[model samples]
Target: MEVQYRSQFPVCSFRLTFAVCVCVRACARAQVCAGAECWSVHSNHTSQPSVCGHDDDAFKYCAYTITYMLLFPIAILSNTGALVVFFWKCWHRSSAFSVVMMNLALSDACFSLTLPLRLAYYFNRGIWYFPDWLCRACVYGFYLNLYTSIFFLTVLSMLRWVAVMQPLRPQVEPVRMARVCVGVWLFVGVASVPFLLNGVTQR
Candidate 1:
């Protein structure tokens, strides 16, 4: 039983990670909790920010602000550098795996670009100065990237296994992997459309 549990650990961890991606893509707000009430102030409105959720929920916002602040720079910068390195490395090579990684890094970089808007929303104390469409886009992009990166990583892992199993197998065509990555982007993009329809609401 112990050995079985140990062997299953990786599967459990993957499931947990996938679950988190689904949840985040559905809501896209780290500060917002399930069934929690939330609202943002319009720039033109002369009203105070509306706080939602329990008293301790304020801590959630604080935590998100700090986390996003720290993550923004690191994710954005690292992913940017990775895209460059991966592109050049994969260039002139039939490394399908590296192509997948380029897409993964690209997805991360795209999402990281949206962090400033999110940070600004939090910085204003929940007052939203951006247009409603922009808000929806940010949330949409967050989830889209979330799922895309997961699928890419999964594909990369499977490819790694194939590489290990048949070390003599010729490298997969980069074009083929690019097609797979495109399919992932399209599938996740279509699935993410529903996220634009909902968000944390105000009282």
Candidate 2:
């Protein structure tokens, strides 16, 4: 009985080892097959952003082509139309309300100008195609618009309150309104100075 038991133990161990080895090889082969399938799917798909993960040359080209040829032009045209209308109609007006609205429009214009660089970045497959300084300048310009919009909106609200509660009080002159608008813009610009100084490159 002892001899039979000892012989059975070795056989059991051998079977266990064989099963483990087979499972490991099957898992490895499954992984390889899955990787190949992914590569094939990527190769067939034309417009995915290859920069985020895959490194195929064909995928990169398709991604750039779609981004530059399709999206960038639309953004530029829309923003340009906005700027033209704002300058022609809004900027020439004199009321405190119009003044704040103009500042908001101008902030939007400045913000829109920064999109071309982003378009270029996507066109270049997540790469920085422009100079390092331009990248920094673009980001700084974008953030400046944020602060400008906020400041101008605050001014607008204050002006609204004064108009409602104190309409009987003497109205602000056009010249003074112009000065307040200019001062608001300048103050917002000054507040954004830190972003400009931070060096807008890479990030």
Candidate 3:
């Protein structure tokens, strides 16, 4: 029985590999039907669905378009409220934690402001009507926001842990925390060079 299974295994593996290869080839040259037009997508290099098509059904791309649409308004409102509250509290009684939270809200709010630009590509149904330079900036900002959020969240976690572990110790000054936030933004911006040098691409 074991020998029989071993003999069939290679055949099963070959069939699976062949199926995947066929799917990849088909997807590489797939032509999407969009109303009165059709376009062939030869390759998709970006994480976003930089695909070929213009249709009312474009937002059918559940991954990016719909997600961005939902994210835009919610992020804007929530972050704005957070920013206002943080600013008011920090103004009256500043602390390292509040300073960090303020910066985080500011970062998210700024990023949310760019959501419209991000959605422009999707709302137009996978087409980039924005200027190439603007496209590159948006792309850079996407990555910058991602890393900045991660870094800020990490800093917040560490600060909380420090507070818990050493409740009696003097809290770090808000001034220094603000400086750290500045340094984080600078480092993230420097690290994420705009893709304009490579030329913004659309499939």
User: Relative to the true structure, how large is the alpha-carbon lDDT of every model?
Assistant: 0.72, 0.57, 0.67
lDDT of 2 by residue, 1-203 (tens): 12111100000111232354455455545554353333333556764432224334544444444543553455456546655654565447645555556556667666666766765776566678677767768877876776766776677677766767776666566567668778877777777677666653453
Greater-TM-score candidate between 2 and 3: 3
Work out the TM-score per prediction: 0.69, 0.54, 0.67
lDDT of 3 by residue, 28-115 (tens): 3454443433334455743433445444244243335555676677777777788888789799999877877777777777777777
Query: CA shift at 67, candidate 1, in angstroms?
Result: 1.7
Descending-lDDT candidate ranking: 1, 3, 2
Against the true structure, candidate 2 reaches a TM-score of 0.54
Candidate 2 residues lying further than 4 Å off, grouped into runs, are 1-93, 123-125, 200-203
Ranking by TM-score: 1, 3, 2
What lDDT is obtained when candidate 3 is compared to the true structure? Answer: 0.67
lDDT head-to-head 1 vs 3, winner: 1
The pairs that clash in candidate 2 are: 136-200
Report the Cα lDDT for residue 168, model 2: 68
Tens-place lDDT digits, model 1, residues 64-169: 5766776777776677778778789787564787788788888878888898898888767788887777888999998988899789889977787776676676
